[model samples]
Target: MKRALEKLGCAPVLEAADGIAAQEVLCRHADVALVLTDITMPRMDGLELLRWGREAVPGAVWIVLSGVETFDSAVAAIRLGAFDFLPKSPHSEELAVAVRNALERRQLLAERERLYLELQRKVHELEQTSEALRRDLQRAEVIQRALLPHSPPPMEGYCIQAVYRPGQHVGGDLYDVVRLGERHLAFYLADATGHGVTSAMLSVLFKQRLVLVDATSGLPLSPAAVLDAVNRSICEAHAAPGLFLTAVFGLLDTSNASLTVASAGHPPVLHLRAGRETRLVRRTGPALGLAHDAQYHEEHLQIAAGDRILLYTDGLVPSGTERDLHRLQQVLAEQRSSVQDILAQLHDAAQGAERDDVTVLLLDAHAGASWFDNGAEGRAAAASRAPRTEQDVVFYGEADEAAWLALRGRATWMQSDVFHETGQAVLAAQRPLVLDLSACEFMDSTCLGTVHELVARGGVTLVGVAPGVHALFEELSMGDVLATVRRDAPAAPELYAIGAGSSQAAVQQRILQAHEALSSLSTRNREEFRDVVESLRGDQQAGGGHG
Candidate 1:
């Protein structure tokens, strides 16, 4: 670089005596621009000197000095990376010009080197960023896949299909088809508060809670129970605040030709029967988390052979479409075709473009009573088929709170009660609990206070809930204290009909159990159905304020 600078009209070159002396001079002034050497010298010839310069001083601009033609020698120097070659007996002006040209070439080479280094640095930086994004995407894919059912149970008489489309790196929509032994299946579609990681996270928590119901509950949990628990969890704990889920939890009873469903502040569901007859089931509960005591109700509808019950999220309801009751009637009346036909027609009616996340789960029940062995042996085989990453216990309804508290007094579990019986069950719970409100249509401060008391006592995990009631808790500031509850059951029943065994005595026992469950429901012990209604009204008022 210095040699090039001197040739740009800066300095002079020092001449040396012999080849050895020249070598020493070259070493001493390594940064010098020009290497002017004579082809014939005392100890070293110009060609030999040129070779030494090529080995030792590669960066310098060289000018060969030879009395002979030196053309071949010059070519050799050039090949050795010399910038330019000159004759020894050249005119003074020519010699000076040659030196200047050599330095000029050196300067150009130096500039090119700088540009190359800068480009390499940029390319390396871009590679690192790309690698980081790749890692993030892989992680996202893993998380999204985990949210889906590993393998939904094969529902007798029905084939199931589930599709997920994530707009960004993650999605907040989810669906599940769980097989609850006895040839029964439970299906649900839920959407979280919003898009992106946080929304996706909340939804995931909700899903885990649904599948992770406390094995200690000692009772076969129903769909209404699941929704109520989910609601209570969100209303009380780690669930979204301004956010809530619009979802449906349904049961497909293959043998009975019936479908039972409970809605949590979601779009109305459409039912397509065998005669091309259609009916729309409207949502009965506030959106999950809206009210601390929002109570979700389940409706049982009978279906003939070939009846198709279509359940979907609000994305197809077309926000404005569901605001009016008429839209539901329209959906039912126009179901002139099959389940697929109704789903498409509903989407078209929903104004597809304003679309939110759309999801549809269809249940088909064909002719005559289709009964599988569903015997103890088949149940045992299914149970032992594979080892689950997560394991949970099943509780019968007859179980008392002591059994539940003993099993999970310390672990986080959300407490929820949507049905009139559930509140009594909560009272029966001895452990501190996280409450769920996904199924409750009502709840008040009294219910909220009890929930708080439970939180103060033991560990809790809350999930699924609505916004209005969520705000109330925010107002009272109890929202942060609730952790969250999750359910892990594969199949949950929505509508429960407790019929006696055979004898009149058995019938009496069934009636007695129902009465006991209902009688036990009281604010003095546990908040009852009244508390749920009250909670819901308060939530509506709170929501109205925001609207």
Candidate 2:
């Protein structure tokens, strides 16, 4: 029968002695798409083989041959997923037609399976591509956020508020406030030409090129010169066609209470005076990166007490709105409560519909008290009545070239004030300052603030810090900021041990509170001591019962 089937157009036909051998042949050759077996055979019958083949290879077609033309056997074979059942004495024409139909059905199913696998492969590739793009956008947003200042740099006698919000994942708007000299502060807000990666990259490049000093003059550049230099830089360095930026730069002379501003086709800024009156400050200059050697003019305004200056980009205004200057003036006039309150109102007005980056800077001339002013005469008057203790003596001595400031006992709020007063001279002196903390056993948050003040002034080194004292610095994440050298022996063994008449729990509680204050320095510091901070906090809440 196999030879006959081959002669009838089945090439390379396989022959099996019984149903078991036929099943074995199907297992060995995966390409065998068709199976023919007799109904009654040795070792595993055709009916069993049909069941196995249907489950093992559903894509293969099966045909059964029987000498006895019993309706029961034919029905049984058909129920086992047999494609066809033929009598043993069937004609060649019938066999050829059955084989032809079975082969055609098998080919169609195989083609469908191949197409389904290809579709699955394409879907997996698309998912991976989408994940990569999402990660890239997330990283871009982080880079852009890091470029902004975490906090305003220390500026004396001025109150500045800056607000920045991006419409999309990233934007092309940026503002920078730089201290150009001892009494001069230069601030600029720039909006690049486009959005997303291209514009963000340009903004970063512009910031790098826009230095505080002019390359030609070497001195701190004026507001007009800074803008002119930036204009030339954009034109020379950036070759991208049609690339340009609109910016406004302001140089503030805090000493004279005056401001000089220059513009490069940016929006007009609003100035609010003491009597609830608003005036527009404007300067006409070509937008940057458009023309080489673009000239700019500076407008000087004498800032008065209780006066406010508003700066913003065009994105603050919704598109299709009237360009009437009165609308903007009214918005700034009505929202005069606080810087944060004004920004809140503007954000509410936008209602998540902003199409571009929004940046607003408000500088209020409050003539506020100076940061360094602590009313030394009043403190001196009070100090004369109260007996001075050795604990309050923060100033130690003046060494060869470096002045030494040591903390003998508890460095709390009083010690902090003493350091601020006596240490001010050390900070101003030409010699280096060395902070000796060997005898210092404890410090509160106020003392840490004084430490930060000294470090900010520069040329201050810490020496002889023990583990208990050093824990406070490490907890505040100031370990890297202050240079400290530990002594061979613990600075103060009494700090770590129970006092002669005091309880150990009381001492530990004080140490824990100081560490808690240190942990409150920043969010990252809190995370670094999460476990220890939580455990110590739980112990404190339990009345120092836990060790």
TM-scores vs. true structure, each candidate: 0.41, 0.58
* lDDT score, candidate 1, position 466: 53
Per-residue lDDT tens digits for candidate 1, residues 120-140, read 999987875675555354335
Q: Model 1 misses residue 468 by how many Å?
A: 67
What's the TM for model 2?
0.58
Candidate 1 residue 513 Cα shift, in angstroms, is: 60
Give the Cα lDDT of each candidate.
0.55, 0.68
User: In model 1, how large is the Cα lDDT of residue 169?
Assistant: 46
lDDT of 2: 0.68
Residue-wise lDDT of candidate 2 within 1-547, one digit each (tens)? 8777888777788888887788778888767778887888889888888888888777789888877656577778888788898888679889889998999988887888999999999997787567545545533554565466545656766777777766565778888777766888888888887777777878887788887786675667888888888888878896778777889998888889899888898888778876856767675598888899789998888888877888887777645244545666666666445544555565546656545776778777873421211112222343446665554535344332454667767777544533543355556534466777877888776577567666757777777775787887776777544454534422321111101111345444544544455566689756765776577668767874643
Best by lDDT: 2
